[model samples]
Target: MLIDFLEFMISASNDSYIFLAGISAVIGAILPLSTIIFANFYEKSTVQTNDLYWELKREVNNSKAFIEGFNKIIYLGDNREIFNSTLKLFKLISYILILLWVLVGVGYIANVSKKPLDSFIISCSTLALISLLIYLPRILSRFQRELPIKVENKSCSINEIYNIFDVKGKGEDKLFYEEILVPTLSIVNTNSKLFIRYNQNLPLNNYKVFYSIQNKNKERLFINIGLLIKNKDFKNIHYTIGNEVSNTDTVQNKFSSIPFGIISKFNEIDSKNSFIYILDSLNQILYTGEVKCIFNSETKISKYTIKTYIDKSPNGHISKLLQNNEKEVHLLDDQQKLTPYYLLDYN
Candidate 1:
């Protein structure tokens, strides 16, 4: 089709307008495809980053849940490796393709234009240079994030959170459950004196804390702050738990211009405590359940977050998920632990 178009364009060869038309046609075809490919590149980066972030987040959260089980989670390093590899692929392929695009733009201009060979070379060279200038940063932009920290055989365990909620289980069930808990969650407010609202039952006496921001008239926002929990006997685990995973279903902020989608519960903390999520979006333990942190590597700072997949209720053939994989956990850690919560802290 490109060739036919090019031929038709060349047939209409009027030195005055042929070059311009050819440039337009070539750009018309290539731009759309390039846009789509670039979008895929962005998507690949996001998906890959989320995989890594959640894995680490889960591992750290689980270890903190129970002090004793931290040792068990260190080995589940599977998804960490997978995400690293996927990210590498995304970077390598993206840069090369972008460079190829510049090359093609230069080549197309040279082929279709009837200018003197010297003039064509000069014009194409300039165009290629411009194209390179535009895409080189694109190739470089993704490199800004440092690669994930290696699981350096050191970790913190909150065995308390793991024991608090039964967050791990079989196969895709666990992963799927986590899908709801985890989100493309990001901190929206960079500067705001904020605090985490806990469900009162959270018993942590020492740890860092933060929470998302809510305004009566704006879209919900996430904010992360660090606070130390030094009072271990504070028995309001329910409030703390609820605070950690509660979907924002309170005072509707009608003062803003942005839309808050479905109560805006995309943010999830990668901890062992099963959050009391009322996926009112679904309604049905299949209705609401806790996010139990199962296991995280005790020996590594790198995470292996896993969850105890649940079916809550008879939502359909959800029960058959366990029978689907090597019998459980589609994505895994280095030690072969399945996702939903980090693995090995299973006390």
Candidate 2:
């Protein structure tokens, strides 16, 4: 009976040991699984937070850059139309967002529950739209108020009408000083002979000059010439004109004869009655005047002269002439009474 009791105790102890080992194995598995779940949750939360921070930072940088570009445009007084249009577009988008917010709010209110996916989306969208509408227009309005400062900063203006003359090409054999000044003969028949001058104190770089003529039937003839007037070599822009056509032909073309080729295109569309226009690079007309064709029936030739009277001014004038038709404006030098100012002459 004692031996039987000893075996039973030993079996009970072994049974207890097995139970403890099972409990320890279960605890070991459960602890690692719990730790893994907690770690995953922590990592996901950290990644989401980092993403939100970066997105907010990027949005802030984009806003700052946009404001800077707008300010630069205002300061330069360039591309104002594009800037205004873009600002208006943003304002319109803000208004649209406000409308969307109102619609979403109505949807949320009509549905009594705020726990659905629809509720979450509507809430977030409404918040964002409300924020944009509250601030966009006031910012744009501030920029619009600064338009007067832009206009005040503009200093480029055509001061007066300078010189007007006709350019005539003599045969290669004709003497230089003996070049004839028969204005009546040159003006009536040739488009190659007319020249007009401008007295702009500004450089010719990025300046465009227009030549237009209207016939009796109301047909318009127009020519636009763009100049690259440099400050260092403004008086010697004949080289610039030559450079415009330098790529066309062989080296046989001389500098003095280059004007003829430049005027070749002008002569193709040339007219006796024409107008000269001065414009900024933006095609804004700074000044304009007429070239009148006076026909002499007895001589059977049209005598051409620069029309300076206000009544006879050409169609493209944005400003009036500082001097009248009778006054002569010299260019480059005061004593050099015969320098031709028209592009067709110098070219």
Q: Quick one: best TM-score, which candidate?
A: 2
User: Tens-digit lDDT track for model 2 on 119-162?
Assistant: 66756765765775557456444443222222112221212111
Clashing pairs in 2: 167-193, 188-302, 205-229, 259-347
Best by lDDT: 2
Report how far off residue 82 is in candidate 2 (Å): 4.2
Which regions of candidate 2 are displaced past 4 Å? 1-75, 112-134, 145-347
TM-score per model over all chains? 0.21, 0.26
For 228-274, candidate 1 gives per-residue lDDT tens digits of: 33323322221100112113423232111221221223233343332
Error of 1 at 279 (Å): 4.2
* Candidate 2, position 224, lDDT: 40
Overall local distance difference test of candidate 1? 0.33
The Cα local distance difference test for each model comes to 0.33, 0.37
